[model samples]
Target: MKVIMYHYVRRYNPSLPHFRFLDVENFKKQLDYFAENFGFVSQSEWATWVTTGQMPHQPDKIILTFDDAMSCHYDYVYPELLKRNLWGIFYACSQPYLTGKMLDVHRTHVLCGAFEGRTLVAASEEVVSPDMIPNREREEFTSQTYRNQENYSGVSRFKRMLNYFVDPALKTHILDKIFEHLDYQVDSKGFYVSQENLIEMNNNGMIIGSHSVTHTLLSTLSLDQQRYELEESFRFIESITAQRDRTYCHPYGGTRSYNKDTLSILEQLNTDYAFSVNYRDIDDTDFVSSRQTLPRYDCNLFPHGLAS
Candidate 1:
């Protein structure tokens, strides 16, 4: 079986043309392809594989997962899944609801989308403080932080610099500087689904899971900080969802985005499954694969996932 991960799934807003998002129509086409090739796995069947590491002798099985719990998942993806009687795990962050502020991870995405990469790069050059310089080599940092991005070359580089080179304490500060330099502000409203929306989805059989409190890279945080990120986010999910499943999708979903401490924290939290963007099929022979940090392919890697 294969698990596919998705983020924003709404049609590209004419307002944010540079913002990379999967169109609804293309998503529908992907669904058709998956239904024809790999039938969507049932909730119980997937649970069995997750719990007992035993999958029935079925090669035509797939699991759909959505990360970030963007409003687009509720507004666009949910109805489409409902139409096909398909289900997906939607991972959510709690900071927006708790603080009414956008997360830095998402704020950077919006800012990176709003302006040209050259423009953002120039702005970053001006705003990058001496204190913010990374301790390691920049090229190595970019290579690891952003291995294979779908963004245009320039934007991808700028994202890598911002994502890795800056200290976490100064990440938002530098982002703010770039936005100020561009004379633009990232809008915080309605970017994510509401608690009521989560409840409705849960009541209707959709599964909900935690992403993190602020979507920071878990590998960068201390043990207690990691625990807080998972615990706080899961608490919010439990408050809203009727589902009893304990699952989490890593913030960046990359292998290096988490650590041994992260797995330990998940085990402590009694989380049954966690997802990472390892881009591989789930092999029943590899019990360790699904046990923790389960692999997931980005939707863009599959046919009909990207616009022509």
Candidate 2:
């Protein structure tokens, strides 16, 4: 069995090309491939089969998962999954959904949509065509811009204050505008799946899983803090799902983000399982492969377009 994770999926609409997510067509092709190629199983079934040796007589099974609860999932992925009668899990970070805070980042994301490919410094350059320059050159330009400024002594003194009240990169075409929007949203808003959204997602067979309340890296925090994060996430997710099942996925499950101590804490919490972003190695014995450290392949990484 293999588990696959996916993030953004939507049409690459140019107007909001920042929101130009994975085109809906490519997303559909992946789904079709999943349906035709292997048995799609829920996380629960996969867990059970791993431990109890019970499966529905299939040669292979794959589990699908999505992270971040991006609005794009609601607009694009959900309908497609429903149309095909597929089930999956959605690991949501609770903060953005509760407040329109996503608008904070998203708005910045939009304003600077054109700067997506450029570095933070290049995006700050005054030139109209910043993207034409390479990242290293852009860094040098921005460094020079900062170096040439005279009133920046006071600016540096109150840097945090300025970051909070105003976006410094507000003049770089689309980039600055995007940051402005995000700043406005984060300071004054919140976005969460409405109660209705949660109920509907569950009813449609999507299991709700925790991605932490604040999305902090668990391994980086103190032991107590890590435990608190794990427990709080478990309770909040269980409340949202109205299920006794407790499962969690580490944020940035890549090499540096999750480590042995983090796994130890999760084991103590007795979480059913936790997923990591690490990929491509699976063996039958891998079933017992540390409940707190399961490897998952991202759909975006593979050629067959299957997520796991």
Candidate 3:
């Protein structure tokens, strides 16, 4: 069984742009292909299959999931999913749902406009100007207190800097301005599905899972911190829906994002399943944990691959 995940799904409207956004036309192709060739399931369905040892008859079993609950997903992807009667796992950070806040790191990434430098150029045909340049200097200015640029590149160092400061409200404000600039129509910072929306998803057969409270790097945090992040997220979700499923997807589920210790902590927290990002599945091991750390294929990678 090979499960795939995605983030954003929207056409590149010149009016509003974002870093993780994927073009809507390509997004349609991915769904059409999967509907024709594979059996689609939700992440929670896979958990039931794994725990109960039920084997799906289909030769190719695929699960669909999205991370961060970006506004684009609500605006574009949700309607598409509903139109097709397809379900998905939307892993959301609880802090925002409860308090309307997000981790500073994400705020920095959005407000800092990291994409404006390289990604914006790649996304658009327009030539970037000095005045239109992204705010790397402001990112550096805010992050220098904790980041050591001599040893790390700006983006890498700023992430580490954000981990040191833990305040959901502060991060929320920074992201507010960023999203506003990205789309002047709405000030949709910390744009996550509301508690009511999560309940609707649950009632509609979609799964609401955890993406941590603050989207912190699990590998960098101590075991206690890691466990806290996972446990709190699980508890918060339960508080919202009164559901028992405690699934977690590492904040940045890339290959090097989380390690063995992180997996061990997930096990310790009694997380039913965990997810990570990759094109292939991790080796399944008993002591290690479930290979449920599923591979998420970024939709932007379509028409070629991740590099494209």
Best candidate per lDDT, number?
Answer: 1
Candidate 1, after superposition: displacement of residue 49 in Å?
1.9
- Can you tell me which runs of candidate 1 are displaced by over 4 Å? none
Candidate lDDT values, in order: 0.82, 0.58, 0.59
Cα lDDT of model 1 by residue, 157-206, tens digit:
67777666677778878877778878897678989888899899888889
User: Which of 1 and 3 is the better model by TM-score?
Assistant: 1
Off by over 4 Å in 2: 18-20, 42-44, 50-59, 97-100, 103-116, 122-192, 303-308
Clashing residue pair totals per candidate (backbone < 3 A): 1, 19, 1
Model 2 scores worst on lDDT over the 10 consecutive residues at 156-165
- Tell me the lDDT of candidate 2: 0.58
**Per-residue lDDT of 1-308 in model 3, one digit per residue for the tens?**
55566765655544333343556767777788777766576545566565764545563666777887776667777778888888777888877766676555545545333344333222221322234333344454354432212222344433433343323234344344444545523344636666777787777667788898878766556777777877788888887765556678878676455777777777777777777766553333421445436555554444421211
**Model 1 weakest 10-residue run by lDDT:** 140-149
Q: Any residue pairs clashing in model 1, and if so which? A: 253-277
Worst 10 residues of 3 by lDDT: 120-129
> Which rank order by lDDT, best down to worst?
1, 3, 2
**Positional deviation of 188 in candidate 2, in angstroms?**
9.1
Per-residue lDDT over 1-308 for candidate 2, one digit per residue giving the tens place of the 0 to 100 score = 66787766755545544333456777777777776777587656665655564554553567778876766677677788888777777888765655445423333334333334343333333323433332333333334322212322232222212122222233223434435533422222322445567668887777778887556555556777777767777776776676544678887566555667778877787777778776663445554765666778777654444211
